[model samples]
Target: MSTPGKVSLEDKFGLFTDHWSPKIVGELNGQQVKLAKISGEFVWHAHEHEDELFLVTRGTLLMRFRDGEQRIGVGEFIIVPRGVEHQPVAETGEVWMLLFEPSSTVNTGTAGGERTVTELERL
Candidate 1:
């Protein structure tokens, strides 16, 4: 069942290590579902045009927004509506994430900081 253009999760796991970086695995409905491992604290930023949905599959994720902040563990999910600034944090170590974002959306938007525009590896 090894068909072309299909990548196993294990294969993607072996392709990354950098923190706060997202890798595009595939696309659907004009959105890209990316897999990333994040650690420490990322800048508080947002896409004024696109909303962000994050689902934690293996660890913990903290969503810090201008109004409030919340922590989610495995099996939990959070959505930061458009035009809201937010930051993500992972304490102690790493957090695995599945990001659902528009196909044209970049990792960072108008607030593009140091982590802006990181290269994505093909999985």
Candidate 2:
């Protein structure tokens, strides 16, 4: 069992400096809340069985789809439904965001590569 307490997002974020690597901050109801500081572009991928929720904490995030793109900013969020092909990009600068998804969800989805994180580190 894990200890129960309040988690400061900012404080947790301060513990890491790498980009694209998500650190688990908390879990609830079989889902995980993760944090990542990202920049540049990610691979085009899709979660066949899991939907992903991205909530921006700082900077900007542009979610690209085959149809179009959505620019998310601070305090903004977007959900990419299952089976939808999408990619996340930070063209402006570094972006900090919280990800809410199932514990089984992988960072790279079906497009596994060097950027794929199979095991997540807990903060």
Candidate 3:
């Protein structure tokens, strides 16, 4: 009722059909929490301004950064700090990514690689 005051997952899912980009589902203070479906390989990027929190809601996620690579299974999470360049790679499976960042966070804050999340893809 009253427009539900929030959009459902199915409605949000109809908002995008791509990769890398995360769709805003809700917010906490000045921080934004979004859900994104991803596959294949993403670009090497960094926030450079703030830390980023990623949760694997489904499937597995492989995050590779300047240091090394870490495999995150479903129900797992990883935190990447500022200025740390990282790339995300999914192994031929669907993944639900919940990202927490500032309200003005960029998909590729300081990146020069391919597969950037310029817009919501596969929301």
Best by lDDT: 2
Clashing pairs in 1: none
Best by TM-score: 2
Cα error, residue 78 of model 1, in Å, equals: 0.8
Q: Candidate 2, residues 1-123: lDDT per residue as tens digits? A: 999889999999999999999999999999999999999999999999999999999999999999999999999999999999999999988999999999999999999999999889999
- List, in order, the clash count of every candidate structure: 0, 0, 3
| Candidate 3, pairs of clashing residues | 17-122, 18-121, 18-122
Question: Tens digit of lDDT per residue, candidate 3, span 1-123?
Answer: 365476566567567766676888877789987888898887788886888889887789999987789999878999998888898889877777788888777887777445555554333
Q: Alpha-carbon error at 25 in model 1, in Å?
A: 0.7
TM-score of each: 0.87, 0.96, 0.79
Q: Model 2 — which ten-residue stretch has the worst lDDT?
A: 1-10
The CA lDDT of each predicted structure is 0.82, 0.96, 0.79
* Cα displacement (Å) at residue 106, model 1: 1.7
Q: Kindly provide the TM-score of model 3 when superposed on the true structure, using C-alpha atoms.
A: 0.79
lDDT of 3 at 119: 55
